[model samples]
Target: MTHATGYAALSAESPMAPFTFERRALRADDVRLDIRYCGVCHFDLHQARDDWHNSVCPCVPGHEIIGTVTEVGPDVTRFQIGDLAAIGCMVDSCMACPECVRGPEQYCVKRSTPTYNGKDRMDGSPTYGGYSDHIVAREQFVLKLPEGLDPERAAPLLCAGITTWSPLRHWKVGPGSRVAVAGLGGLGHMGVKLAVGLGAEVTVVTTSPAKSADALALGAH
Candidate 1:
């Protein structure tokens, strides 16, 4: 077990406060990371506040995480100590399901294990999250941070960035494609940036005219 410290909500009405806990011991396929940055996703807020009515007490909420690899289990091969790494909302899934085999682990026949406010598939222990000093995740769920990317800025890419990037890629948005983003919030701004990068003509549709400059600066039309 590894001692970890982070902020946690003790109850639905409680604000997050400093809490100490233990991270599970390394499993053969697990990777340990020294967390460097964690992006605040609104989902984290919902979970912390028990807005979904299912949040467990001592909820440590964060998912968009960037860290430096500090250790890897014996069977791990994808990362090495000192490598920049990340973890998204998912930590594990049943790997034999058709959905998992095809790469969409989120749809695993057995529900995917969330980063926090979830139970560990192996021991049913409550899972904590990335708003901490470090974390342990299965090798399969860890991501390699690209060499030149800024780790601090890349944290949100695990959540908001990929959330938008997936649909854009699925639709094959590219040169000559017209993409209209509906809002200029976290996800929308990321969508605009990604679509523009994919060579699409991007447009921002928002009720707030005050955000026009912000939208255009993000490469929207």
Candidate 2:
């Protein structure tokens, strides 16, 4: 067993404490990462407190991971040592399934393996997450960190950026199109940024007028 250290809540309602556990050794398709800075998203709270009823005890919580690739499995052709990479909210999935075959494991009809607090399909052991010093995951789940972007700021884009891609594209909005992004939370902020990036005139709808300036400051037009 590979040893690892992370912060974890011993039980629901308890503060996260130091934790040590075993990580599975590298497999033919695995990539090992030396985790850099991980963003603390608000969902951390929900998962820590069992708000969604998906909490796994000794829960080590985090998914937005930006790191340097330290090792790659023999069959991993996409990345090599010293390359910057990212692990999002997913780690593994049954590649034989239709969704996996299409290259969108997030929509895997059999359900993709989530980053943390998930079960490993092969070993039947619990999978932990990115709130740790390192992670070893199958190469398919790793996203290449763009050289142009700052990894710290780019971390949230893994989960946040992908969620808002649909609504904007679904409406076929483009230059001169008026778009409305509701709310100002993490996901909402990503929505505003994306809409503006796509050349849409974006107005963020918020019950709190306090967020109006923030929305505008974040590139919402």
- Go through the candidates in order and give each one's C-alpha lDDT: 0.95, 0.88
What are the clash counts of all predictions, listed in order? Answer: 0, 0
> For each candidate, what TM-score against the reference?
0.99, 0.95
Q: lDDT tens string, model 2, 1-221?
A: 57999999778879999999988888999999999978787787788888899889888888899999998889999999999999988899999888799887888888888888889888978888889999999998998998889987988887787778776888887899998888999899999888888899999999999999999898887
TM-score attained by model 2:
0.95
Cα RMSD for candidate 1? 0.7
Per-residue lDDT tens digits for candidate 1, residues 104-214, read 999999999999999999999999999999999999999999889999799999999999999999999999999999999999999999999999999999999999999
Please give the lDDT score for candidate 1. Answer: 0.95
Backbone clash pairs for candidate 1 read: none
- The true-structure Cα RMSD of candidate 2 reads 1.3
